[model samples]
Target: MADDFADVYARLRTIMLEAAPAMTINRDEAGALELRMPGIDPKTKQPGWFGTVTTKKSYVAFHLMPLYTAPDLADDISPALAKRKQGKTCFNFKNVDNVLFEELSALARRCAAT
Candidate 1:
């Protein structure tokens, strides 16, 4: 692991946690921290998936489920931010400096607000 990888993970995880205070959090079997929020399942009327955040080998990933559920808002990602995106919901960060921290924090807040 890189010397600053844990720092990056901590900062990104904190951003996600602050974005959704009502989210339910737990430690995964893989030893990653997980945060989730429940929603109605529409057809079944049961709890549904909302969002999540987890750490991976080289980068920390922020999984914004709302983008999968909504699809449109994701199109607005700026060129600079798009460089970090791994998929529709997965944004990977290898280095977490002040700029990346602020960007991820803002993104988390926006996703949480949806």
Candidate 2:
């Protein structure tokens, strides 16, 4: 079955919104998408931690951040997730698991709080 990144992103956005109804999500200028939660202090406001599932002609890439704003988080997840494609990181699954989705939502919430 062929996979579409835009559809995947929309599903993820829906899941995130269901998890945190107050959160806002939209695509950025670079065509990358972003999510933000309400009530975040303006001074501390920052883009929510995000994951990307990019589709290439050959394969799909699942770029997840186990932690954001801290390099160690990416480092920790990278080793376990490391499989390269054209010198880039990729994930085998077409769809992410429920646990990962929940974790991503949690990370977004945490980032919004700060």
Candidate 3:
């Protein structure tokens, strides 16, 4: 089970990294991966959030903050990916879905540009 989650996390993390090459890596480890725009937010005094892939107990989470700020990005989401969404910005998964991951990769690229 843990191995499955690790594989899922790895694949999702790769999509994020490949899609958003300009973003800064906030965390990269077995349990979590985060990417952020390269600057501090005046309001929060922290880097602007871009996305994250995190391993939770039951599943992994892929979060794209741009989806929250730029609703248009959601327009590109497929129903398959939509079923995994837990919130405006977060998608949870128990296993890897290559089709969904490809869609997610495209979304991340668009998000990175915004």
Q: Largest lDDT belongs to which candidate?
A: 3
Which stretches of model 1 miss by more than 4 angstroms? 1-3, 28-31, 42-46
What TM-score does prediction 2 earn?
0.39
lDDT of 1 by residue, 3-26 (tens): 657777677777877887776764
Where does candidate 3 clash, by residue pair? none
**True-vs-predicted CA distance for residue 79, candidate 2, Å:** 9.6
CA RMSD of each candidate after superposition? 2.7, 6.4, 1.3
Ranking by TM-score: 3, 1, 2
Taking all chains together, the TM-score of candidate 3 against the true structure is: 0.93
Question: Any idea what lDDT model 2 has?
Answer: 0.43
**Cα lDDT computed for each candidate against the true fold:** 0.69, 0.43, 0.88
What RMSD does model 1 have? 2.7
Worst 10 residues of 1 by lDDT: 26-35
CA shift of 85, model 1, Å: 0.5
